[model samples]
Target: MAAQQSQGIQTLLEAEKEAAKIVQQARQYRVQKLKDARSEASKEIEEYKKAKEQEFKAFEASHAGTTSTTQAALDKETDAKLKEIEALFQSKKKDVVNTLLQRATQVQPELNRNLKKLQA
Candidate 1:
């Protein structure tokens, strides 16, 4: 009777070990599935973003020739260009002022360093 009881206990331990192994495998599978799902979701989100960007680009291209919005955009762009031109003039304003001053004073001001460098 004691030997039979020991055998039963051994069998129970073996069964428990197998159950534990199955549980561990199930946990691993669940983790892998979750990772796969998250990766898929991330890929889908990126695809959605790309699709939205393309749609927006298409809409913008289609509307670029429309009168109302196009004119406003053109006006804004024109203003930007004008501002750039104004900035360029401002940047060269000192040179222009110096040249004008020398002409008015009838004195040859020192030659421009940049011009001398360029000539050399």
Candidate 2:
């Protein structure tokens, strides 16, 4: 009976050691799996970020082209309007100067005649 008890104790110790070894192996596997998952997620995030950056850059480039074309058209219209105004000013300037000169010459002769009569 004593020998039987000693054999039972040895069997129980072996079983406990095997259970501890299995638990340790499971913990190591879980840690390695978590590390792998984190690595995959980080890679995917970086790829998504790069794709978004490229998309935004393309959008900005298109917007800039549209803006430049619109600005050029607006500038052309402004230049045409300025030219028309300049032409109108040039065309009217000669007539205005000639009329003023004629009026001044006619009025001066009458004023001198009146002054001579008053002196006499």
lDDT of each: 0.96, 0.96
The residue-by-residue lDDT of candidate 1 on 5-51, one tens digit each, is 99999999999999999999999999999999999999999999999
- Candidate 1 has what TM-score? 0.56
Q: Which tens-of-lDDT digit does each residue in 17-110 have in candidate 2? A: 9999999999999999999999999999999999999999999998998999999999999999999999999999999999999998777434
Error of 1 at 82 (Å): 22
Which pairs of residues have clashing backbones in candidate 1?
none
Error of 1 at 76 (Å): 15
Candidate 2, superposed: residue stretches over 4 Å from native: 71-120
Each candidate: RMSD to true structure?
12.0, 10.8
* TM-scores of all candidate predictions against the true structure: 0.56, 0.58
